[model samples]
Target: MTLTHRLLSPLIVALAFSAPVVTHAATDPSFVLTATSKNFDNYFPSYLANGYFSTMTSVRGSEANLAYMVAFMDYAKDDIARPAAIPGWSGIDYSTGKSTAGEFWLNRTLLSDKAFSDYQQTLDMHNGTLTTRYRYTDDSQKSTRIEITTFVSQADTHLAATRITITPEFDGSVQLSFPLNIWAPHQPRFPIGKMTGDEMLAAVAANNMSVTEPVNYRTADRAPVWYHGDTNVSNDDGSTKDLTLQLDGKAEQGLHMAEAAAIELPKGIKPSDITLDKSTYQLALNMKVPVHKGHAYSFTKYVAMSRESWGGDASATAALAKKARSTGFDKLLAAHQTAWHTLWQSDIVIDGDAKVQQAVHSDLYYLLSNSTSGTAWPMGACALTPNYAGHAFWDSDSWVFPALLLLHPDRAKPIVMFRHRTMQPARERAIQYGAKGTMYPWEADPETGIDYTPHFAYGVFREIHVNADVAIAQWQYYLASGDSAWLKANGWPVIKEVADFWVSRVSYDKANDRYEILHVTSPDEAYDDVPNDSFTNAAARKALDIATAAATKVGASPDPQWADISKKMYIPFDAKARRHLDFDASVPHDKITWMGSSLAWLMYPNLDLPMSPEIRKNDFDFQLEELKVHGNDPNEMMMVMLATAAAEVGDGKTAGEWLQRNLVGFLKPPYNVRSETASNNAGYILATSAGFVQSLVYGLSGLRIDDNGLTEAYAPALPPTWKSLTLKHITFRGKRYDITVDRDAAGNAKLTRKAL
Candidate 1:
């Protein structure tokens, strides 16, 4: 059998479900070449810093947001309360739970504390108003004072003023300090027990999340507190003695206890009635003294301006906090809505099918809601809310990049730049392993480049594919932007480093006479430590080619031996199976099926190599057969991949089906309009929006971009319910193409394109 037939065996059977009979007609060649463009006016702003917590000011202009978050650094504490062991925490499996305590429980504790109390408070956005009030009390007769402050500024700008004061009844000595350590979803600190700051930084650069100390706080003063005695605290454990109190009559104490405190009071006052007030009393004593009389001590804390308390050095965080404070509490929510307005204003509305139009918009809404700027982390699974500890992974760069690059180049640049910023870390990781190039981590904390992979069984230790994934992203950015200067400056060195690492890591398979990548994991975690993985080999070969081509143009040359090595690089294809081999022949292959194989890794964004029509058909069929209805649904990203792939192969019915599946199951759910996938709201938005765009461009207009240029092979393939489709400022080759498709009274389709 020929190479095409073998790969198509499964596809042909799958396509039979909805295959159209091929017919000859006078195709309009001129119409196909007509180029059109559309320009979108709407742009979504990154609102919530990390999606889980919202930074907002109350009516009185006081800011309230998560100031500082740390997951009890001690590993022993983690073992006692593993995040995975707790029910309802997503992505964490207790069987493979590496952390002693899971993230969910830790976050709960922080949110419930007197210091980090409110989780999701609403802000009244009428005028520039903000309000907040919190209080504290002391036990012994020292001096106590309560102060409140408020601040406000420009919506996008980060400068603000805070007014604070202290009142003392009988003064002794008192010091006031604020904690500057801040963390968001996807940027949690690595647990204690692993490495140093430099080593942790190196691990993060490669997209690995298995290192120790992912996040840390820089202290202003190193003075220690004086311990008083053990204070009984209450928790879910039913134990009341989980902490010891530090008495400082004046100094601040680090509250790191595991449970809530219950203190014994003096004669007339009760512990529960203690409140912050203007009086002389002992501060931070055993939780029992009633410092304040009848009222709950309330003081306003400006959450939005807290980042700017010290100096301008906190500009990045301040900028982020400002965005969240002013806009709605979701990443890029308001901005995304604005972006949609611009998209609609550009007149890219689908006319033939109303369902298609709504579906496309729904997808775009998902994308806009889930992604943002000024955040070090990649978009989470859901872009609106925070349930998943947001981490950047290979899926974003590989599967999502293509769709984002074509229509949203401006938004796409930052995503690419995120990788660029981490290149040094990747390079250092390669060096540590005695390899020559950059190694991207499989998972990475956004704020701090900490490896967070808790389990070795999840293939955290063998994640070599991430390096090539980064190289591919760099190459794709160059292809879409055609920015050679960027390629020469920022892109070239990183590519060279990645290329060097691959060369050093791969072994010369003497028996096969090819340079082979061994013991690497594919994108899907089900298969681990496979030899000469087809996807890995293909990416490596492509990275090498692009890096070499770009390097040659930029006048950078590696040792002459590099050319010979590139030539001998191995990519395994099964002759008998007529498909790309999952790994080398010697490696065991799990015959069990997996979703997302068809276009998830290859076609949608990576675009490394094109699959034959037959192979594409088989892959689609395989995914359909393996589709899970509920409970642990496959990654929502897979839906976008399949939709785009279906459009590429000119299967409108299938494309529509997949789009509907995503919308109904994950995008629009039993849980009202909230995303059904895990809590990564941004993931829901990007995947759905990209899926809709694909339904219009790839499915209806049949547009595809490759090395040669943009190709419009197929004409309008309107779903049975559609009437017309229009798209504007669709970008390709740094030029915008405006396109419109409509079906006439007799259901005959019409096409129009113009370059803007």
Candidate 2:
């Protein structure tokens, strides 16, 4: 069952998906990809969320030349009503790290400006690399071909670079037009806002849409001139971000460059203009170059999309990007390759199954691409997708935090620290929302950890359990890192603030003689304003306990409220069914069709509620029924939990079944899209991967972090179908450990540690 490695896309890929699943290196080896597209899509899967560019195409890998950046503003974090009235743009990210929202200045066609035919495209993804090749014919029936390689700068977290090679069949000129489009962010009627069609038009006419003024790009004093500007961007949810974009290309020596108005270009007047009006978003850059039949033209474009709040001068940043491009592309690529190697070196390794290993690595690759060290932008729900105004969601604390905690704690710290930094806004919101202490936002981001979840969804109003989830992540971080220094400095304060929030957020019910959370959305999110949900209540109770324990550990007094609330918190129990109900029994719990495994969360990660084996079985049986009714494989985040539960209860067969279903259903057989929902692709990066890895470590292998190095409560029950299960080089508190579980009558498994 040993696996062999193979070369892919100029590097060694250790696994494959074909029969037997392992092979030696090949010149043209298969790739483990996020899927390359034939056409450009805003939501196309990206190669490296680690960089600041999107490399997605539709059916055939076509650039289509559209760009959007993510940035955040300090204006209003929780103000969604009449968002168009906001004055400035505040957003985050443009393929690299968080930047100010700026215009991408899309071009209609570059290099091949005229009508062409027989278009052909090819794309490849190896690990996290995406390469796209395009070919077409110009209006004169002359053949043209180009290859573009895009990557976020590993050397610089906020830069992206592309190397383009052009080859033509005829000696013709290449002209590019930077025409303002109907859909770029600069347009007033851009569909990024909540209002669409007539409503959007009305908003735009009223000058209240999330739009930037038409600011034409300008040229700096260098060839492949650096052009950058700032513009206002708004979202429906009270967000105003000033984003900036940069475009600087180094063309061949025999090329000529000119800039003019899009309308003037039609007249072919060759206007002598080097500057543009601030009101013109569409400015054209024309390049005329000599082409020989067999010679190829090559150039590199360096770009940086930044936001005002990011604090870096966009113009200077753009200029720096261009300067870096002056160096050979191979040099930049070597640094980038080293970065990926470092990430992979620190990753969790799986042995015995090459296909399963590749799938795991794919999940991990997206995780690394989407998160970086010291960047406050936790992997947003959709990683880089524009949802919740590009804000980090609760998915961060619960899903993203744990996996990075186990493998890349450096990246995981930002997830937890973001809560700490945003606590002030959270507390202010708590007071504003008529609650106590710091209540973390569901759609949290920079500017403030403000709530960006829409009001209609009931998440902002009632899904208050996110506070506890934040605390849970903090607790897990401490356990993994044993960083008491960090605990005293940052972790404890957050624990205290959140614990204070939950204590004041809960209410005492004189009628029932218990503590209850009312008008709340449970983690399932399918139902709203439910009372006394077992998941939420249990989580709240755990939050209090964590706060108190953390306070004591930090030489502070434990909060008395924590004990009082947790002791009396109401948990919806089903006496007849021998399990827990979705909500309080008195609230018609039987009538509700809950859609997730939040209760299962209480069993695995939180373990807030005490349960017997039979009770666990009954709970799981009911959850199976819920999945039968509504859990769509493409979007659901519970298969990992089910597998964890199965492993927790010592059901090896069931655990293996759940794992196989996830591999086949989610990653390979049915839909390998990684994500089905655009609402927040963070689920793809965090929920899917974290849950899978957590199930293996904490579920099947029964591994739990303790003060005494590594410990396991139950011998891992390896499924008969698997030859063995092994994890290599997992980091905890600056140390690395490896574990292997082999199926034998004695249940032989081994754990080893690196010497300090």
Candidate 3:
């Protein structure tokens, strides 16, 4: 069997579940994700994020050394001039792996075997909290239980808190330790050829590596530059003279991270001793706490991490940590809960299928957690890991931004602003490519506002559709938001420039009397340098139309050619077959690794490329059947597009099956964190989550955004198992509406819209 066939096995199994599997209802206040030893791999722990910071930890406290923590930093030039692994916030001591135990682990108090029982962790999405509890017996045969609760605050973007509570079965004294350390040092990882001249000199000087004929240095993998804190001296130093030299000047400029932490003891309790280790710069606190049976004593730790590269102040970090400690965990948690509660107001409600409802909730939670209103730092495709070098892509505007625009326009605004703020770089990129108007890069760097696409990928030059994607998001934001002031200030510039670009990009065929976009990469990614790709052509046409309307709304003269270009945009279609082709010369049902849905997007979202129901059904049948014939495994967004297109065509059964395929293919267990593929190579892809959620809002409910604003485009086509599907608090034209799609006794879906 081919690898693609193996990838489809999960979807095949999902087809077996014709009936609803009984599960906890999403409405249950206690509906929370629980993590166990069996649920998550130790290496890749479950994740928690709040836009600014993210943390991952295992249930076994003993393996706390392996915990991962990262905070958002504005882009900076470090060891290399390209995308590389930036320093994390796990602390200098934490990265060394010397501390086998964590702050939660009881020091020298457990039995000889040191085994823990009844370990479980509950992740409450509503509160954005992770609560871990476990019990262990001491050498005295006395039972003790510990609970640790952690959260990255939504109220304060810089603050993170962890509160630990201990209860003793009998009256006994236990020793506890708290750690304070600087942020983890930068350990640069990148190809040597990607480094600048000064970076190479520094690396060669520090590592004593030979670099003869440096001008002709081969592009090869190099060891990460070891930035050692005083604590790491023991691990790296041999002689005292060498150690002194390394400590004095080895650390590079623009790489230092300023981190501060404070610990708050319970009332009437104080630490027995406080000591700081100079070697590791790790502060330790030894506290003997007296506890009675059934009584709990708690301590909270507050940490604030920032970086010079991120424009962070060391004093501010210390002050923030101090403020959080004084505010106490109860109040901090309350504020965080209040913030998340307000965000969750816009939600997806599914009845009769608890599993689907839970998955939707998880999707909403992750997307919301990865984005905030005021920052221009858009979310990457994958939220947790630096997948694709943490660079924003069309995924942000095309997939993630659309999902948020309907539910939370406030969060979506920053995504568009990210593009607006980087327009200078885009203009420069256009000049670089000899194109008219602004040309947004395929991979956008947040800090530098430059195209971060590596030299290896041709996408920087060929993936020209990103310009249209960016403009579509801006115009859609204006239509949904009804923010004319913003449209004038931010939206007009982007849309107008994009319009000028399309005017310059298209070549007029005087003989054919039409315009065409040639030598482009379609979203399918399988075919590159193709002429008049259907998805690109349709999007370009839509973008031109949007640009024309935006210019009119903003009191700017509309581009004369925009209308002509949009009217005569060459979208490849087979007239006799009544089906759309991927390109001017294309074969239907060809083996596309990134199969299906590129053409489907033109039908469902764009709603252009005029096709009849017969054509739509033919396209849907061919795409679905092609998945099995040549071992074609489609991407997550493709599944969403197929599902949405099927729903638009009133094929609820096929749409429902595709929805099930998405759930089984991408979403993981315990937490519905989505993977890029069914094989789970890159997990926590926010774009997949957004696409799945989009189907629930726009597909099942049959909602579409147009000049008239949030109107029903087609009949609701909900899955058979889904008795009712509701999109609550959808914002459009400065108003909120609740849309419910319900199936009648006759088994036909009906939709109702209620304004709030």
Candidate 4:
């Protein structure tokens, strides 16, 4: 579809059908261009081009449900208590086998009834492109049926890349059985090997595996295994019989295995009860399956059969598996890739800065790789990184959603729906905190929907603004996508609940004749426990306005109560400081500063506060003087926000400077990869990509959207060394626009925009 038609068709139809017009636009193409940077190539090669397998380690449980488990019999060890070690093993120092006595040993010793630890794992690749087979046995020679299903996409060209749920069944006494043999082209490696039986037992004892919290134990054991799988495994196995085992370490040699014994079931219950039902268990496997540059590999495996003794019929499982195989898995994976392609296809390229192009693609790839299927929470809000222990934060809705909406509106919807799915939990949180409306958590455990904000001081200060942030994101989604069904169903209810909360939560300041948000912190945590926080007030007002507007549009009654409260919401301004206060009475310190001044509260959307040229200059000066700490804190998001703000105020010179600083200072150079933290950072390369987008859209092109329409203020301030720039698919005023800024042969500069 043409960019103009794709963006404006819905609005035109809505206007014809008596619906309100939503003036949303796609990203600019010049800004969306692609390039090869050593920095990006070194840090995020998976995003640069097409590939088959991408492994995801579960930062939280929501991500953990996507892997499988494998066990094996230790034939070399005369006693199952101590399995013989393979040669030349080197991986994690942790023990793998179970142990009872010889507590100080490093091998598996069966003690306290815990079964020997089994490796939990998973395989991910393009759907239908590759097939995987595992060899194993069942009790008494009963038939073992394996079933397989794909969860993400069903397209033939794309891979089913998300969660792969696995269930295993067996016959006989409910003893532990190791069924999986190989992951096809890739062989498994034992990291801890070669210790004596006593040492193995001691190591297992020291590890302290727990029975009740099986998930934790499974995760800890599986992480080391997969880490080895990704980093060490090679495709060349000598033969099927010589499966290329790497167990040279003493711990592996002394590893013990438990005798095959099943859990005892009650009489009259079928053997199936003792196996698949009563013995239901889960494991998390995160292994990086290698992929050739241009070739696609599909990951396939059978969820091994249910035992015959329990009338094990694979019909239902098989049917579901076939359905996934036929349609869901491949289609989902393809759609995800298509989503990324759509980003590249609709990208607005910038001509001069090669770094900008690389950064943009990297960000787009990161967002695609980490997002989930509809109704599933996005990859813990932090996008597969270990920062914040994989917890979902307010940034998912406030910052991430907005960026996605402009670039890829279709994929952006699911993220908003995820918030709707969690509404009930949010409501419950509100009641727990003695509030009238929903109070979303500042940080949430992705799988459990549990809040985990630790109290630092006197009392647990609830970041009440999260509820407002959610409401605004949903409203923005509605505006961008023009999905009335979503608005009426998902958006309306959330809007009402959040609006209700604001109404009940705000207190009337009789002296000032304004509604006050008391004891709230703005987006920047520099100032806390302040009254009438300007950022919070601005967001609350925006939320109230959107809620009222959406309510009116959907034929819902506009609550007059909201009007009274909205009229009174306080937005504090500092006259002497000559800049907006972070919060009411926010004291500016000589040394104490916000972590990232670029992400100050006023910069976010729906807040509707503009930074004047004078104010922008002052804020830039303040940030440069005080906020540029070592440059690694707050991850890459800080750079993105800073670039965005710099672009906003027509300071192209400053914006370009900031962009280059991030690229060279943190994103490039000696490290040459994106880092999660200062010391133990992994190569996560999305932040710089996002920064590139922000620099172009918010900086040079000056695109801003609102109810009236899209507005463009030309502000191209390229460095003197650069000659020209061009961008395509820059959306504004309900139209697709292509813009170019270049210096003519005569040295005169020109800016041109044409409706697509």
Top TM-score model: 3
| Steric clashes per prediction | 87, 50, 2, 81
Task: State each model's C-alpha RMSD to the native.
Answer: 17.0, 12.1, 8.3, 17.4
Candidate 3 global CA lDDT score: 0.65
Any idea what lDDT model 2 has?
A: 0.52
TM-score of each: 0.57, 0.75, 0.82, 0.58
Please give the TM-score that candidate 4 achieves against the real structure: 0.58
Best by lDDT: 3
Sorting all predicted structures by lDDT, with the top scorer first, yields 3, 2, 4, 1
User: What are the lDDT figures for the candidates, one per model?
Assistant: 0.42, 0.52, 0.65, 0.43
| Pairs of residues at least 3 apart in sequence or in different chains that clash in candidate 3 | 231-279, 231-280
* Candidate number with the higher TM-score (1 or 2): 2
Taking the tens digit of each residue's C-alpha lDDT, what string does model 4 give over 1-756? Answer: 011101111100000011111111343322222111112112121221121112222111011121111111121222211111111111101111122321121112222111212211111221111111221122222221212222332222122232222222322222221111222211332222233433433333344465344332211222211121111111211111211111001122222211010111122423221111111121111121222222222223212111111112234323333444345343545665455444455454656776655555445555655553343454443344322324455656765566666655655566577677777877888888778767777655454445544222112243467777888888877776666787998989989889988887888889988888887764554455667766678788888888889998799998888877877778776688677655665545333332444224466343446657777556655555446652224444455555656666655666677677666434422212343222223344333344455556545656555665544543555544456555666433235666666666775445676778
Residue 443, candidate 2: alpha-carbon lDDT = 65
lDDT of 3 by residue, 136-165 (tens): 654445667777878878888777777777
Q: Residue 560 of model 2: what lDDT? A: 91
lDDT of 4 at 24: 19
lDDT of 1: 0.42
